[model samples]
Target chain A: MTTITVATRPTEAPAGHRLRFMFADMITVTWRNLLALTRIPEALFFTTLQPIMFVLLFRYVFGGAIPIPGGIPYVDYMMPGIFVQAVMFGAVGTSVGLAEDLQKGLIERFRALPMARSAVLAGRTTADAVRNVFVVLIMTGVAFAVGFRINTTVVDYVLGAALLVAFAYSMSWGFAAIGLAAPNSETAQVMAFPILIPLTFASTAFVPIQALPGWLQVFARHQPVSVVINGARSLMVGGYYHSTSSLWYALLWIAALLIVLVPLGVWRYRKTS
Target chain B: MGANSSIAVDAHDLVKVFPRGHVRALDGVSLEVEAGTILGLLGPNGAGKTTAVRILSTIIGPDSGHATILGHDVVKEADTVRRIIGLAGQNAAVDDYLTGRENIRMVGRLSHMSWKSVGARADELLETFGLTDAGNRVLKTYSGGMRRRLDLAAALVAQPPILFLDEPTTGLDPQSRQDLWRVIEGLVAEGTTVLLTTQYLEEADRLARDIVVIDHGRVIAQGTPAQLKADLGTSVVSVTLADAGTAQRAAVLLAPLSAQPPLVEGATVDLTVDDGPKVAVEVLRSLDSAALSLAGLALREPSLDDVFLTLTGHKAEVANDGGTPA
Candidate 1:
């Protein structure tokens, strides 16, 4: 027969040790989510395939009709927006993942553990961000195949991609709150669609802000999604759409979202029944 | 009461109400579990058993009242309490996408075990749970019993002294349930204190050193299995008549033989008495004199099932759904 030992009395971890454990717990949880993602090939396939389909649909079907100002190629102008849109859509996975965990009782298990409470949400958002990175890389290859070119240096391109992923990560915290609040995965997806559709479509992800009506154009130009898309466009393409202010505005929005949503998500997680 | 250092889990007047339906899941419930023993929280479905376990395990804070694990407050010192307790909730609480080995290792890592210990412990747990062959396979491929075993194995990754099993064997087959019972008994033999919630009367009878019966979010009775059964009587003489009408007559005929009235369910009449063989002979003689033919007769000691029925006014196996919303 196998022998088991009784646990020793529990002692509180010191402050520095607690901090280190938090990071270690976050990494472990992150690895768990990513490992689950890899096992579900259909989920990965659909997430990446949806973006490629969007790229093909926009480049071949909508490219000729939509003209870019300053004679910039439509493919080049649209690719950056497509990259931002892909990651933004990918952020919804955070909501679905968290809701699924809650529904399947994994959240209860995690909450009962000695690990840091923030690790669950942090690990989830981080894993979704990593997935966004993979999706963006694949989109980059597809954009190149469709005659899209980066007019800027490799560093600028990388910066733009980083901005998109960071924005996606911040959005994930907001979706994390939604996921925890939702009762189940189906409802989480349903709740996310209304918020996501308006943000992506009303912004400059698919069309220019100038193409919209006057009243809508104001919102289109100033919205966080539009600001980030313009920031990415400025970094990668650098033409009429380029503005140094867009970068600052995008960073400001990301910071604001992270500040508000991180605590909000963690609070919702703590308050989850 | 002064601090009872030997109590592994102690709660005082716990109450919880789910805000959605305003269901009072737990109402002024209090219980304690002594270290190195199993306290079976026995109840029917939706009787707040899961809610009680949730509060004690630090999964959710009670609306009112407080609890402590190993003398540390569950709410104020949840992190400390978490370090010393493992909970296998009503659901498996395991990742369906991960392998059995990975699930154990993940929990070990989260429990803050060293990487080397995590690996060795994962192997040991898988072997102990009889999951060694399936350790490399993802959980999606496991059967219901394997998943439950893995869930329990994952819970023991840190070898927490206190364990809360909330209906751990609710839906398992007879074989699987017995296997789980043996495992739980082995753990307790090794000095692991367990707070087990179950609707299975036999489970409580076989595994629990003490029993607490809760219904409608309230504790109706509490004692050891024998004590609870003895509260009803020393023996249970069950007689199965040919029909419900005969059973009702048999109940009335046998009612005066014991302090408690006979429990009649359709064609079966069960009476609690101070003596088994003596009362059983009296019951058969009385039934025969009344000209009622007996289909079957059994004389045995009082069981938790009879205790639950006497206390709750319903059979223990009956599902009282939507009562507590647990």
Candidate 2:
């Protein structure tokens, strides 16, 4: 009997030895999603193409109609907001991907494995963040070609881009929760728009805060999306609207969202069918 | 050996009710699989087969009761049990965007294998499952059979001592199912304890040493294939007449030799008999004396279908949708 037990026993790790395993599992899952992105060029094409279209449509088509409040070019003024908007859209892709995995029963497969429970959600959001970074870089290049310039120092521009990516990464957790709650990817995509429309459209992403009605102006200026967009906009192109305090407020928003949504996503994932 | 040590999978009175509508997926289900043996969980669609597998594999917790794999509690020691079990779900849960080799490697890495050995094991599995030629192709481009094979390969990459397969061949072509059965046989030969849930009676008969049949979230019957058939007392005799018109008359003639009345369908007369060959010979002699020209005559042992029908009071195929027969 002892021999049978010895022969069949699974390899046991030392007490509390799973910390490194958790990191490894997370990285492996991240690597898998990233590999998938590379293999499916269409996913990359569509993700990159949408931002390019936004840059073009907002810059050329809506650029003439939209007025710049700070005497700045509409293109430069809108680029920060566009970057935040593009990154937000990119983050929604996380929800879609997660919902697709759930619908396809991939999550059940992951659950049957012995790896870290947090690895699947962590890896998914991390992969989308990495993809968001790439989209931001490509959009930056496109902005540069279209006469969009960073008026501030290079460090500030880099900081602004980093904050945008971080915000996008934080938002991915909220999307993860939505994905786990949603029945399918199509519903996730459709349902995300309602929540996103008020955030992006009502904020300072497209037009100036002054363009909105007086009642909506309060929310338009004070909302987290506006704070982050205005914060990134200040760091990239210095203007009277560039307030240093907004950056801290944006960071606080990102941190608060991560604190709330990470647990919610993981909890939802564990309870998912 | 102690009882727990001898039993690889020991589940007791597991009960799971879905929270939303309170759907009773498992109602006091219990069973055990001995070490290094095969146990087939037989059921129809929605008979809680997948739910039972999920609970035993620790993918989902049971609402009540307990289960253990290799003496490690599925809920309390889920991580340890997970390390020792491999599961191939009904959907063949391999990622579509990954190549067969990459899929195997990913599972190996998740199992905490070193990168070098993971690579080697991936190659070896790809070869073993006959996916070496298509190893580099993304799974979306592979055939359904190829994807199912890849899923099985991924599950086996870590060589877990216990395996749970939930309808592993549900959507597979016949040849692919045969190939998978052969691979599974090889795994059992290597001393892996397997608990497979399948709707196909033949699958259970061919692979499982012990079979447990569940329906409507309860165990309807369980035993070895032969024992189950004998318990049904369903040995049968069939005689085909040269004339379809004579079948009814033959049924009347054969009724006295059978335990129940004979059934005539087209040119054949079927008799429910206890001693098949003896009754078959008796029926033939009577039919010949009556000048009923015989085209064929045979005695047949009871099949799993008869056992299922007798126990459930309905044919297995009829009550197979996990509900009362339509």
Candidate 3:
């Protein structure tokens, strides 16, 4: 038999080219995740439906009962919070996706490849950010149908949506770490809900911080969710509720989360066995 | 390129102990695979076969010792090793949400193939693997064998010279297993070096040029299939008695017939001998004169099964406390 030559040479490129390859690898992984999301219609259906249900529950069920501090319309007061809540909930997909990949040995396959080590986590979070945008747009439409209006300029409204997505993207990194830590998708879901529940409900996402008991009010006002919700409220409504400080605090919270969770998620990804 | 390197895979005294369960998965295990040949890592469940593969593939590092693929360190030079090696683990790692073609292409892209070649290579692999018709269908709709085929195709997308197959056909049906064996043989003919771990003796005998028999994370025997069988003897004289007690007595009676002692397993006694027909006559006459009632008797060539039973004192499928299953 004729002997064939082995391809054992290292395929290392220049440092600049490697960086570009890393970005391309991340995009490829992101595209793969989005393609998977499209195939699972039920998952996307439930993700979109949950936010719409939250909008209706707060708009009609509790809108009349909870009076705003400044006599603002409850729909306007709650819509910004609803947008934040929707993206936060949508970010859970990042955890579930990563856990599933880990459980199914897809992560092992990716690890064996010559791709960038950070590509898997970065790609997953970016894909969830894209999904958050879609879910946020759908929630906005539902909010509009249910008597929610943007009192600010169209540019400010766009900025508000962008802020919500940024927050969602940062949360995706946090959830990505959880997903890597959990053994399976079910465990990831169970672990994520406990953290998400108090952060979204105990904050100003649905109810006014002043209406909460005094003991809970301090936490309800200062949490990241509340800060981002209030910032989105200022950007979208811009009345007595508007404050430049709220927007700055929201940006700072997003920056802090990214700074802490990005490396944490990548570290978790590498450490996952 | 190290294309002419004699030893495609060189591992030395590799040791690994998992923190969970404190399982010593690999205990001073070491083996080498020559270029352009297949080496079968033969073992039962939890014999550190998967652990060895994981370490060689650079998925995890050994607690001690070291391995190199074509002179590139598996741990320190992992990125370089990754460029030349492909791993298809026990589980089919292809995504259920993507099509067969799409899965191959995605792996190609991750392996750093140019976009132009990734698409063409994916299509070429799908066709070669007989998945061209089902290439467009999502993997959720594929059968177990199809998924296994696609998983292997994905691994080969970058044309890696060295391949690690960790029980690639463990759960496949008989026909699918044969099909995979044929594909593997074809690949080996083209000079792709393979390190295949298997619990199936027949699979190792059929595919590997050399086999390393491991038990409890240690190599007990290593040789070609023919040589291993020859070491047991030329032929085996098997006799089925009425009960376990009678079989034990018959083993003592027939122990002098062969150089090695008879192996008694419940109601059957097996004795390896140099001559088949001559040994068969002697065995029957001795048992008859001893008044031992024989249910059946047969003489056949010594298979790897006999070699394994002689060396390990147990069947290949019997699990021992070596480590967790892969």
Highest lDDT against the true fold, candidate = 1
Candidate 2 stretches with Cα past 4 Å from truth are A1-7, B20-22, B239-271, B281-297, B313-326
User: How do the predictions measure up, each by TM-score?
Assistant: 0.96, 0.92, 0.95
Error of 3 at A195 (Å): 0.7
Per-residue CA lDDT of model 1 for B194-219, tens digit only, reads 99999889888999999999999999
Q: Which has the greatest TM-score?
A: 1
lDDT ranking of the models: 1, 3, 2
Model 2 score (lDDT): 0.85
Interface RMSD of each: 1.7, 6.4, 3.9
Against the native chain B, each candidate's TM-score is 0.93, 0.85, 0.92
In the range A105-159, model 1's lDDT, one tens digit per residue, is 9989998999999999999999999999988898898899989888888889989
lDDT of 2 by residue, B252-312 (tens): 8777886655656689877767777777778878988998899998778877765665555
DockQ, per model, reads 0.69, 0.41, 0.50
How far is B59's C-alpha from truth in model 3 (Å)? 0.1
DockQ metric, candidate 3? 0.50
Ranking by DockQ: 1, 3, 2
- Looking at model 2, the pairs that clash are none
The residue ranges of model 3 lying beyond 4 angstroms of the native Cα positions read A1-16, B1-4, B243-249, B256-261, B318-326
lDDT of 3 by residue, A1-273 (tens): 112223544455335578888899999999999999999989988988988888888888988898887667899999988888889888888999999999999999998888999899989999999998898878888988998888889899989999999999999999999999998999998999998999999999878888899999989888999999999989998988889999999999999999999999988887888
Candidate 3 structure quality by residue, lDDT tens digits, B100-190: 9889999999998888998988877887788999999999999888988889889888888899999888877778887888888877887
